[model samples]
Target chain A: MGDVTVTKSPDGVWCLCRLVRERLKAEVEEMKSQFSGFRPGLVVLQVGDRDDSNLYISSKLKAAAEIGIDAKHLRLPNTTTQDEVLQSILSVNQNLSVHGLIVQLPLDSVSSIDTELITNAVCPEKDVDGLSCMNAGKLSRGDLSDCFIPCTPNGCMELIRQTGVSVAGKHAVVIGRSKIVGAPMHDLLLWNHATVTTCHSKTLDLPEQVGRADVLVVGAGRAEMVRGEWLKEGAVVIDCGINHIPDETKLSGKRVVGDVHYASANQRAGFITPVPGGVGPMTVAMLMESALRVTLCSLTGGRRHGNSSGVVNRK
Target chain B: MGDVTVTKSPDGVWCLCRLVRERLKAEVEEMKSQFSGFRPGLVVLQVGDRDDSNLYISSKLKAAAEIGIDAKHLRLPNTTTQDEVLQSILSVNQNLSVHGLIVQLPLDSVSSIDTELITNAVCPEKDVDGLSCMNAGKLSRGDLSDCFIPCTPNGCMELIRQTGVSVAGKHAVVIGRSKIVGAPMHDLLLWNHATVTTCHSKTLDLPEQVGRADVLVVGAGRAEMVRGEWLKEGAVVIDCGINHIPDETKLSGKRVVGDVHYASANQRAGFITPVPGGVGPMTVAMLMESALRVTLCSLTGGRRHGNSSGVVNRK
Candidate 1:
């Protein structure tokens, strides 16, 4: 057998992340000249900060800073009411300076908050997180050029593009149906002309289903639930899952793993993403890309130049 | 081999149609008693009379009359401008008397009209046709209760329910990706807990795809494309295509057929919908159902009680 290719090395992810950020930085500098010191702005709204949420938000903030975006962290008290959370979002929605808004999920609140309602409160135009129904709807209906796609799936597409395997006429199996990942990924792939099958928790014979995939994307949230033996040899496998498994050797006594067993899966897969270095950095990178696009569109007073095929063609 | 049971016999459709109409008639009569002669109203806006459109409109009008719905045929001239069409829909959207509205497609206008733009203008509230991006988006995101599902797929689900085969966990294969049929059908089945695979023109190995389905839905618009040999034994086949083929014996020198080769498919399929009396009649029946639902929801001053599971559980 030929040597197996790891889809993304730690260095490779850092390189790609650096590439996207540097490009954005250059663009931001160019915009400063064209628009009289105009800066693209983003707001990350968080409530009742869960530790994991804080960590994720911090990563996003760090990325935004690196890319020269005017980023703000709008942290609310843990006891913030739903209406109060909504008011915060609405204020950002009306803020002409802020071009992008993302609500940090799993709101840590003493009061019962409706996550869907809160997510939908962000205006579709500024919804860089792409969780709002309006944006999700636009994405689902093959209006890829017109809506903001969720970050993970968008990043996964970018990774798949790097593999140089044409998505058209390929069999794409998406493992999960979460609004954020699996569902939109299926739409993106289908519009790209792949025959897409979505398999979830209830899917009987998961291995059998995964075997037919030329491209398999797993966001099932289960830790290494998909075995290497289930993969079709030489398939392009993208693991979106970030599960924590205990390991006595580690200082934290736990190690991060993806939805697929990386060690075994790499033996069979033509390409596979490592849990830490693969989709994680790319997700943050895509968020920056989206934030930049939103900023540009707002500044230009026009819509995002949507690609009809739903695939990012940017070199 | 097991007996090949036809999904919808002409008599069965007639019976089902009558049952629904009679129930609707009773409901209308009850509403008359409560609201003092408030008849459920529907407006069918037709632009440029294609004969097929006319025939479909006539059937809708007939069905509405039987159900005591005050159905109006709003016919516009072939030379009508797109602006005029939009104005017509906008006026209907504001009219309190009208609860449901459908624009007959293939706008036979002399001037080029943006169909998607016009379809979106119908106001999601009155869009009984469910072609609007808003409704399509809601349906795509598994928000089945909050959206009007396109009638054909809605009716297909009703037929599938009638078959007593559980959709959940089943491998459902849908051919085609048109917004109205295949795409929506995929969403509907996926939400119903089925493992759905959507195949279109770009799909490789169509037969292999078909062979794996526990439930097969074909709406490729190509006549007799799916042969019996491709089907898994006892597969429940739902054919949504209506293509006219040469039949010299007929007075019109043509006959209607489905995407599946019915005669041959019956040999392998445990349950299969016939061409003329199958999905065709059910589509009309579903349109009537949707119109009635919109009217009832309007009168109730509350949202229609949406079934989260998305299957029509009405006996």
Candidate 2:
């Protein structure tokens, strides 16, 4: 009998945090030396003080600080009115020092403040979150120049590109279709020349579809919903889902998990990302990159004015 | 052996032209009775004398006239300057009588006029082509309530929905990725909850991918590229391709064909759209529909004045 090759052992998830951190730190130091009083300024607007929102804001601020970017957190009470949020966004938009502005999502869904209206109010130039219709439209049309890509999907793309697998002609299956992650990921993969398939909660044959992927990106936000057995051999798996489940073993009585079953997926998959350290750090890194881009555009007067060529002119 | 049941013959392409035409005519007659001077006025701007563009404009005008809509063909010389085209568009945009304006595509590509710039110059309200960033972005974000969906893809969707197949949970494979048909088709299908896979020139295993689809939409514009043998059993095929090939047998010395091999695909497919009679008529019909929508919006004072609530909140 031909010797059975042992299944390749679990390769450690690519440690992007250190690499991105060092690069950002270097960029910041160089900028400081070249241009005095030049620091990228980012503001995070939060309302209702959700616990998870607080955690996300703190991590973002820490990442910004590490890279020498000035970060501010603007908090609003649960009772904040729509006008109040819009007024704050307008003021921040006018602030020349604020290079990037992000309104933290899930802003009290029960409240009268329309999320879409508030997000659109942010100056497109400073819309670091890239949720505004203008940026989303530009991204959908495959125009990346001078556009801020949403951080999570952008980070996921960076991770997939780092795998050294050419995206062109590859079958990439994305699970989930949220505006932020899944939809943008679909566009990004399509733009990179991948035969992309998007499977959501409505997908009938999830296993069969997932099994067909050369590169599988799961962002369904369900903890460990994707099993390892369904993965194609040598598939590159990117888990964008960050879910927390109760765990008696931890002091906090909870542990973070991704959409994929990491332990099992690691065995069969050629490349897989672990939940906590994989996509989380990369999201922060991409945000820093967005901030830097916005800052540079502001400095160089590359800020797009009204009714210009919105399509990215591909040379 | 039990009777093969003949694998159900290919159903005739849903004749959306007749349906849309009849409905539009009814609406126009009703409007004539209800309000005087309420005819929907559409202006077609042709920058060059392209034969195909001429044919398209004539059909559009014929359709508009049949429905009591005022249609004007504004022919610009091939030597028309960019400013002249822009000036014409601006005048048409300001003309209160004109509800919709479309600049025929491939308008003197040799000229200094940038197609993107020219198209973007049209007021989004009058952009019946729906190629503007505003409409494309709104469509991408799944906000279809107030957006003018690009005609061809909208027609394709209308045909598919007429097939009585629920798009949700279907594995829809779209061949082609052009901004006009394929890209928008992908978004429309995705919005309808289909697990959509976009296959283009970069697709390596076209046969395998096509075989996996329960619903296949082909718009590669190549003459009969997809064969029946490659299709999944009982798959519904929507061919958006319109390609011409020389045939000595015809007096015109040419015949029109689709991206799919009709003879072979019709044998195995449960539903198949014929080339000349399929998506082409639907495209014209949808264009008329777009004009009517814009006109009604204008008459009812639904004209969006500002950036407030871009999402079309249908009453």
Quantify all predictions' global Cα lDDT against the true fold.
Answer: 0.85, 0.82
lDDT by residue for model 2 over B1-315, one digit each (tens)? Answer: 121222232324434467778888898888777787578899999988998998989999999999899999999999998998999999998999999998899896457888777877999899888888777777787777657778888788777766677677889999987768888888888877889999999999999999988889998989999999999888878899989999999999999899999999988887778888888888888888888878877877775221111223532
Off by over 4 Å in 2: A1-14, A302-315, B1-15, B301-315
Query: Predicted candidate 2: what Cα RMSD to the true structure?
Result: 4.8
TM-score of each: 0.95, 0.91
lDDT for A100 (candidate 2): 95
DockQ for each model: 0.73, 0.71
Clashing pairs in 2: none
- Model 1, span B1-315: residue lDDT tens: 243333434566556556656877887888888889888889999999899899889988998888788899999999999899999999999999999898988788888899888998998888887888778777788878778888889878877766778788999999998878988899999988999999999998999999999999999999999999999999989999989999999999999999999988988887888888777777777787787777778878766434223644432
TM-score of chain A of 2: 0.91
| CAPRI rating of model 1 | medium
